[model samples]
Target: MFEEWSDRRTLRVFDPPRPVWVDMAATGMAGGFTPANTVPLRVRTSGARLEQRMQGWQHAWLQVSDGRWVAVVSVRLSSANEQSHASIPLTVAAGAIRPAESVTKDEP
Candidate 1:
């Protein structure tokens, strides 16, 4: 799944261990700022894939840009099952600096 906010982009993917539904939610926090709304992520899979007797995992990537700042969040799920759920908490710094090397530039 992909999401685009005012100045951010987010991507999420799921790999389930069984043919069940999984839900995911995330919230953002900053000083003197309460958390925003919770976003629900839904995942579905086929039974054949679940019965294959193999390990499963899920991946999620989130990127946030607030004009002067950029942030990223990555999530990994292991052995996900029917009752699997993930809650992620995000913190935004008011005056943090990110190294230049950490920013990805367009490939030549």
Candidate 2:
């Protein structure tokens, strides 16, 4: 789980098996845009993994699966009266274990 915030620039990253969330608030925009908005996009990983990248102003949500992993990376830019927040959720399996290897050496 990770959280980050900034007045002008902000970046955040989320790790799987944990809850990842972010929030932002902007006041007073130079441009005539009131109550700014954010755009969000997501990318899934191969075989039980999730990945996402965010830019500008955006937020995201991710679902977790059993024996799976998830990750999210995001960035934000804010102006007066325009704030953006982003969040991602990752779920993983609980009962999946990897097998261990045994090594043996023979000496004369």
Clashing pairs in 2: 27-81, 28-80, 28-81, 29-80, 64-91, 67-93
lDDT string for model 2 (29-76, tens) is: 112432323322221111121113112211222334342332232323
lDDT of 2 at 58: 17
Off by over 4 Å in 1: 1-67, 76-82, 86-108
lDDT of 2: 0.24
After superposing candidate 2, which stretches have Cα over 4 Å from the reference?
1-65, 79-108
User: What's the TM-score of every candidate structure?
Assistant: 0.17, 0.17
The number of residue pairs in model 1 that clash at the backbone is 0
The best candidate in terms of lDDT:
1
TM-score of 2: 0.17
- lDDT digits (tens) for residues 58-87 of candidate 1: 233334443333223322233234455332
Please give the RMSD to the true structure for each candidate, in Å: 15.3, 19.8
